[model samples]
Target: MAWEQVQKALKDHLGDSIYNLWIDPLECVSYRADEVRLACPDRFYRAHLDRNHLATVQQIVTELSGNDCKVILCDKETAILPAAQPKGQLRLPHIPERKSVVRALHPRYTFDAFMLGESNLLAQSACKSMINGDDTVGSCLYINSSTGLGKSHLTHAVAHALLADSPQTRLRYVTAQQFASEMVRSIQSRSMDTFKSVYHDHCDFLLVEDIHSLQGKKKTQEEMNELLDALIKSGKRVILTANNAPRDLKGIDNEFRSRMGAGLVTTIQAPDLATRYRIVEHKAVQSGLNLEEDVISYISQQIQGDVRRIESALLSLSAKATLAGGAVEMDMVRDVVAEIVGLSTNLTTTLIGEIISREFNVSYKDLQSRSRKKVISFPRQVAMYLGRKHTEESLGEIGKVFNRNHATVLHAVKVVSELCRCDTSVRRQMEILDRKMAEM
Candidate 1:
């Protein structure tokens, strides 16, 4: 009952996502008035817990047990070892044999490592359903999103879970380009049957990434269509990811697109502000960085959309702190944020206008023109919106860059904000521009 109480307290304090990722997997070895023991999944999990969570566990245990209780955390293997083993005997943890994979899966890309948010909850849930053999999700799933939005992460997670749960599962994970190249090699060597046989007969689960690359390749498309047909007929599970939806993909045949869209089609949107905060916190803890709350909030606010940018910023922060005698201050964080977002000192309204003009294919001078043409006016509005976001300029100051008034700049920001909420295409373009600005 005390253990249950501790679990409830942890869930309440740390929130569901963090609790599920770290604490929920832990097994209770024993509990007593003065001592409690917990078993972690492995050395990696145990080390992380000891570094980040052990003190919290000890405090909670002491309060619940009404004594100065000591908490012992060890790997599952050590917890389950024979009681007769000699005292202080060294034992190496047993490691499972690695499963064969076409491309090595990242060890940290498993489902537990994925941060759930409003933008990606559906995609994550659907992947979990497919892996759990829930019939509602069907046998095929397609996830589409822009770069660095966790498309590959989810696919790798599915593969990792499958092989771990069912080691004998004949899984084939490859990119669309890799699949096309292998097919070409098979044809060149006059051994197409062997290639077909490998996917058709030997595979139980198939994962293909970046199906957008298969566009305009008719022969590859034909072979892929036939392969999908065979795999589906045999009730094999398949997952494919791309940067575009099936119907939106260019140069892809209708039948092949139909197959891709047959089961479930999900898209991952950019993380919202709250989700971005959680991501920043989670990454900082994982990297063993003792960043202050204000630092985390600042990074989350500045770095939008891409998860990779956050990682890069944190890594840079860590290096800088180490060089400066391990002190992280607000000024250091500001410099890191500016560097990651590609702002030299600050992002000027002029630079924002130029980037928008180039992206919208309108001349920079035209943006400052009085023309009401949709092409010219739309880009000007976007520039105004971005200027308000990336610079400390007032609305009037931002409007001066476009030869417009503060009222016009404010209206542009409002209109573009609403459009980003209602229109997927608009939101996607903004995400692209956001990335471009960060990389500039």
Candidate 2:
């Protein structure tokens, strides 16, 4: 069978999500009798497929070609680095090269519009400095946090602020997925020169969101690495957002991850209960609806983590009230809460430990172990606090999960509570971790 047929067969066997995130980035560069060579964009992709999917690929190749075939996977040669293009007037091909436009900025996501709580105060300040011409913050700033935490909002606000100050400032904002798709298209069209020219020559400031989404696309990863190097070398500003920290990112190249970490790295924590209440009220006013205090309080308690979910609940209640021809009361709010909160499954302490561990880059074993090290001890305290807050587990029950006495759990809970009141950073960390556990 033809290589195209094999490709189609594999894509059909694996679903779109798996294929696109993993297999679609591969290029079958050469083939011989019973042996096929696949060129991947980077070493990480080659290792990933070799470990997880190569056996299945071999099976598919055998079924397709009616013979046992050997699959050799390796990184694509860097010799295709666009120096071969003849120096002269450019020629337009019959088919146009693919391109993606940056997503439009949300008008509501201005700096003044963003609600400032302790959770996002630092991030907000950093972003303001960037807008105010503080180039000392380094050319690359990485902002990472769980979903609905305001990374996107901050980036959008930065764009608006920059443009407001100087409309002629050239900026481009795209999700990591868009950049990866464009990279794939450029490879297909053999027009990488055009891709490099667009990013290096056109963008004065570039912001990419959800960069964690570019996990398995090594070519796109390499392309982004190059783009970042060029932009930073030329003193152009670049900002990137992801769900997790650079050190926690799996399947990304080490050199690229180091570059991401070399600059300022900041996280947006989940909002605390009071902050959630404020958010509901803020969003309520923005939606032009008046919500009762009791109703807002009820939502503040029920919707655990995601501000987006809180906004969604408010929208639903507002819509329902409009349809029912009545004000939003506690009963209506309870109904909305049930509808929204019921969708989330109950969380487990084991899961909570995992999320906190990943967020702090502490090992799960260390978290549960009896270690008095400040780093491990504090995360353990936060875990204990989260356990009491998010789960139905009693203090003694939670103690069993952490291999401690009930009094120990209680002490941990107290310490974290006090720290939350005193340390803004600790408070924000708990807020973000609690939501991630509850949402998970």
Candidate 3:
């Protein structure tokens, strides 16, 4: 009975193709005197419905009711549906089942939780469209932002939304290193076929965190290329996050770069003072701490780093106050992060070694104990390379950490440099490691 008159109007006016595609799928939600809320499953559907057929929809309603009536797409949100396919029906598709790298989904990344400021509207719509499965939008979604822009949260939100609606949807969220590590293990185990099947053929969607890590590794580039092409060809969606654009992913394949650029690209710009305050207040509320607006404003104004540090300062103040059984006042924030503002310090020797060990097979002990073997030295060279990249320490000081002269440190940098140009595997490893260190 809801759209009875409207239906008659539509039948009288629009042809069948436009009717079926545009109006057929819309579901009516609650309505008020001012608005008749209609919603399509995804934004693409909404855009299509609105673009080609809004006039017809409006005309139908106006004629049927003898007054103006309108339609609006429901929120671009998909409800998680039960995923149990009939026996033998939706059995896990033959995609690769690499060990999932989604350590945890952010509780705040859902549509209900995200602060819907105007800045992120386009991206939100794109995410909603991709989640809704219109297929017009390219599968490769690029979220560009500097540190602390909540890119990861948005990425996770898309992953959660899609898999929620279609539980049978094959989804894996991972950092680039984890992707490489899984691939490396697959190659080692001679189950590259399974890896290939799981990662490329079987995956319905892949949300890769920090794809800039793919910049250098030729092997990772090729492996990623094959996986991307497979997914792209099969109509699977991929979401990628990075600190910079595809062009900035040094050493990445031009073809892959071209493909990434083909999709929707959006950036999370640095938050304004108001946004930063909102972030502070949000973090403070989670900790059951409250600060005065003036104080929140001051703390937000003082900080210039990513969202990570802003939250950290909030937590630090809360912890300090909690230990003293006090409040997270502005004075407390000021006292805690005073030194953290506009200050960049050298990467400590220990942190540098751990980064090296994680990147290369070299042990932390080997980093300082003078290992010249290819395996050990390769990691050591990586450590030196990162040191040059991320610290105030001079090359001579870095040499001291490695028990080598400055010239040797320079050589290590050069050696990795030359290897990165030709060896895809080596390049991928270094890039991932470098990003890891930078994030830390």
Candidate 4:
């Protein structure tokens, strides 16, 4: 049960290969009467530890008759991870009194990294100005845009700017749903004081992404209202980003809606061809691809609509060409485009069969079969969502590909789309998968 004993057991059994592979990088995050905590430095570490190291540690504890043990891997970038002190302990540090330390800041998204133009210049300027004492003190700035138009980037940039002194600023950023869950935890633990202080009074700024996540949680909205009032009264600024503005947060109270709208509100419409081309150029530079003007325009026009989709297309195309030790050309780009938008990737029958199988979690024969079950229904819809989310194909076209009616395809897309929006686990999984599909 002692810290030294745990360390010795791990060192004795885990050996250099497994220890370095699984345990060495983690910090002994905490230990209370019934639980011990471990913290890893990044997502890769957390994934490996959770998959491989967790069982070994649990077995060791069970052998020694230790208290019920659990391993929680915290994202070091977020407030989720506890900082370790020297001497095998972690401090339960309160969110600091000074408002300079914040998590939820994506270091890759500074003003310098954001691809800005007319669409986001004002919002970007406000973000850049905030750290320099140029506070945009409005009730809230409402930024709404179609997915992948840099709203998340701008939100993180603002948080990073405000927390110019990393250790001193105590900013708390979360989706509205996470805000709700944390509020419940605060109430149960009788630590609402720390929760409110961390989320409200201790921070000079609050940034909430995906305000739509708050659509149905009334009790959480009430808690947020209190936090909002305390923050505004204290002259702190709050930044909110969502798919829609305050007036559209379904099921929210009217007064709370007004409170959100008391400041500047802006909506970013979907990109035009010109904006999409600019995005493709920016993306080409980001990806180290020297795209010709014609190539950029070709991709921009083809991908259309969401800037994120266009960039994704471009990055994936360029990555594929580079990996094959070939130059990026119209032909290379055209092949990728055809497959995603049509049936033109030169995929061998075996590879094409493999992809279809993975997409729907059905064997090629099963997909060809006539089974009607929840398992198939689920992955079929997931494949439809992928076709809709990742490719520029028409619904009818996607239906033909899946050998289903257009209406059925549309229904699958709708159900999966809604699930991705409300279901966090599904949302994260699809995001990762969508990224992978584009790369392929």
Report clashes for each candidate as comma-separated counts: 0, 1, 14, 5
Predicted candidate 2 versus true structure: per-residue lDDT over 1-440, tens digit per residue: 34665566567666688888888888877665468888888998789989988876776665434345788887897412212545765535532222223478888988887878657888888888766658767778899899998998999999888777845456777899878876676567454554565687657788899889878777778888889999889888889999999999988988888877878898898775556767888899887778887666557656867788888888898899899885777677777888888844467665566556656768667887889999898888888888888888898988887788899999999999999999999888777766656444
Better of 1 and 2 by lDDT: 1
Model 2: CA > 4 A from native: 1-101, 343-440
Whole-model lDDT, model 3? 0.69
Error in Å for residue 57 of model 1? 58
- In model 1, where do residues sit more than 4 Å from their true spots? 1-100, 344-440
How do the predictions measure up, each by TM-score?
0.58, 0.58, 0.54, 0.55
Worst 10 residues of 1 by lDDT: 91-100
In model 1, how large is the Cα lDDT of residue 83?
A: 39
lDDT (tens digit, per residue) of candidate 3 on 1-440:
13643554464456577667677777766443334667687888777777777766654443223234555555447533324444754334453322232447876777765554434566677777788886666777888888877787788787677657766676777788888987886577454554565566446778888888877788987888778877877888888888898877788889888877778888777664445656777777877777886666556656754888877777778779988878565556667777556443335544666545634545566677755677887778878887877787888998988788999889988988999999999888778766655543
Give the better candidate number (2 or 3) by lDDT: 2
- Model 2 scores a C-alpha lDDT of 0.76
Q: Which stretches of candidate 3 lie over 4 Å from their true place?
A: 1-101, 342-440
lDDT of 4 by residue, 237-296 (tens): 777788877877788888778878877788776554455666778778878888887687
User: What is the Cα-based lDDT of residue 29 in candidate 3?
Assistant: 64
Q: Assess the local accuracy of residue 59 in candidate 2 as a C-alpha lDDT between 0 and 100.
A: 63
Candidate lDDT (C-alpha), each = 0.82, 0.76, 0.69, 0.65
